[model samples]
Target: MTDRTPGEPTGLDIALQWAELPPEHLKAALQALEPELARRHEMRMLQARLEAQGAEDRRSHLLYLSGLVGGFLIVVAMLTASVIVGINGLPWLSAMLAGPSVLSLAGLFVLRRVDSGTARQVARAHDAALGAAQPTPGAGVV
Candidate 1:
């Protein structure tokens, strides 16, 4: 890391010194800087919030896809077991097959519902963030 001394003159300080402003002028400068700095910080916070929301949306989508794939695989397994039972004349496997298949399908249904809800929420958040970032007409223009 670069060495940074406390109370060192930064670029802004040097520029201010070059301008040779009085002490009261310096205080006025700081007052003028405050609102612009606060607005910049607010913009950064909004960006971070949008990023977090996008990440959550991606995670939710992945979970929904995995659940769908898993449920499909379970269904295939059930079908395979049914075929095996039919060929081998085994009656007990049928009961074993129904339970997990039903549970997996139910879980997939719930996951799909949740994923749809999350998609809507993500869309709303994206729209809101975009709206917030946009400059309004006749605002903030010198």
Candidate 2:
């Protein structure tokens, strides 16, 4: 005869539930899930690193574009300023515009360096994860 209690899990259910016990108890209770968990962790780390690389690339592209825009604006402004300088004679204003345009080029160079560094970090994480993979080619790492 079997008496049933509401909200009480079966023995199999209990065993399955025990599978999620934290790392310390995990070795004793359920070793099966460890490989799955490791794979999940690897995937998550890979995704995060890849996203960081992508963001860095986009930032670099934007900086380069901004620099190009600054250069183009300087050209147009210089043309107009030259006409004004010839007629009204204010050469200093044209020189001021040139300064900001040159400064933008420097800023773009710095941003590209930052972007490359961030991309390198992402690559390094990927390499680390790959190295971790070689040690546990089997299902059970332990």
Which candidate achieves the best lDDT against the true structure? 1
Candidate 1 whole-model C-alpha lDDT, 0 to 1: 0.64
Q: For candidate 2, what's the RMSD?
A: 26.0
Each candidate's TM vs. the true structure? 0.60, 0.44
Clashing pairs in 2: none
lDDT of 1 by residue, 1-142 (tens): 2233788655487557746877787777777767866776788888889999999999999888887787777777777786687467554454445433445454555455445565565556555544554557989678
Clashes by residue pair, model 1: none
The per-residue C-alpha lDDT of model 1 at residue 85 equals 71
Q: Give candidates' CA RMSD values in order.
A: 24.1, 26.0
Model 1 RMSD to the real structure?
Answer: 24.1
Range of the 10 consecutive residues with the lowest summed lDDT in candidate 1: 95-104
TM-score of 2: 0.44
Query: Taking the tens digit of each residue's C-alpha lDDT, what string does model 2 give over 12-110?
Result: 675677767866674555466556557767888888899999999999889788866775665666566656764665445444433343344344444
